[model samples]
Target: MSGEQLNEVRKVIWLTGASSGIGRSLALGLAAEGHQVIASARSDVELAVLETLSSNITALPCDITDASGLSFLRARLSHLSSHLDQIILCAGNCEYLDFPEPDWDMVTRVMEVNYFGAVNCVKTALPLLRQSAAERPHIVAVASMVTDAPFPRAEAYGASKAAMRYFFDCLRLDLRSEHIDVSVVNPGFVDTPLTQKNNFPMPFLLSAEDASRRIIENLESRPKNYSFPKRLLCLLAVSKILPALWQKIVLNGADGKARQDVLNEKVGE
Candidate 1:
């Protein structure tokens, strides 16, 4: 299909983690394209701000960690409209595992938000997605490119995303007969409030707007997997293809202090 035709296809979209980063950018971009967007996040204030920024957006704030809250989300969305064309699960958290001491609690926290939170949203949104009779339903998950290869100190964050990737890939198979399309978005570093906390360098990092545009563009194609910044993806591919060399030379030298900090934090915890 042509790009113009893809752009013309409009439908109701529910987006999680819409308070900031790629989620926020995508909400704005999709809304500008005349699609009805329900923006969700834990922060009501941020969701409110996003609602003001776009005429097509309606703020729906809820913490994905709360299962009961998701039921409330279902009720609220049911009130908005009976069906949804797409559900973008972007709510996630990242925590690095430092070397000397690994904090199990930190890992659990990351998993709860990154993995379980997404599953909860899926459980709640399935009915709405099923209501789409004309357009094929889509589920877009915001996983990380870090899952492509292991990165130092990214134990918790990477594992959570890896689990998410596996879940959606499995879901794709099960939802096939139902005509639901699943897309996994594996983004390289994007400048966002979350990454702003990183003391180390983020090579080939794209602006959130750029990331958002790429995501929206790829979503139209409805590819099973979408990963960005060819250079970073290529690098990760090379590392995966040659693990020994990458371990000794590339990955080991990236960020020493950050790795040490992660270890220290784990030890302290």
Candidate 2:
């Protein structure tokens, strides 16, 4: 659809993780464009602030990791709108493993939010999306480019996003028959509350607002998979080609000593 067409037609959208980061920015952007955005997040304070931003936005606070809360959210959504034209699943959690004494449970914790949380949202939104009058109702999952290349300490996060990407890919195939468009958005480093905690270098990092704008612009096309920025995607492609070189760069110090040392310092702080 063209920019004019998007502005002409209003869509009922359900956006998760709207308290901060990309989700919050997306909700604001969509609402500004005259879309009815039902925004959700775990933070009541932040959601309340968002609700004050525009009448197009409705704050619905719910923890993606909480099954009961999500169930309640579904009921609330049903009451608010019988159908949804779009559902953006941006809710996710990230955790790095501390090697040698890694917190094993963190893997489950991360997956529960990043992968299963999205799954639950899809379950709740699919039926609503089926009722859409639009030619193609959309499901957008904000995954990560970390899945394209292996990163130390990002095992859980990378794995969860990879799983999400695959699941959505399969879902796209199945939902094609129903005219439900599914797009997996794989973003590189974006300066959000999540990435603000990173101690390492993040090349090509875009601000959350810029990232959200890019995503919103591209989403109009409803592509199967949208990954950005092109520069970072290219870098990851090169890394995959040279396995030995890639390993050397990732494990710079022998036995990953340099990586571990940095992590240890962060933990100390």
Candidate 2: regions farther than 4 A off = 1-9, 253-269
Weakest ten-residue segment in model 1 by summed lDDT:
1-10
Residue 189 of model 1, lDDT score:
93
**Model 2: per-residue lDDT, tens digit, 113-185?**
9999999999888888998889999999999999998988999999999999999999999999999999999
Local distance difference test scores for all models: 0.85, 0.86
Q: List the residue pairs that clash in candidate 1.
A: 98-262, 98-263, 99-263
Worst lDDT run of 10 residues, candidate 2, spans: 1-10
Clash count, one per candidate: 3, 0
Taking all chains together, each candidate's TM-score versus the true structure is: 0.89, 0.90
Model 1 deviation from native, Cα RMSD in Å? 7.1
Candidate 1 per-residue C-alpha lDDT over 57-76 given as tens digits, one digit per residue, 9 for 90 to 100 = 88888989997777788988
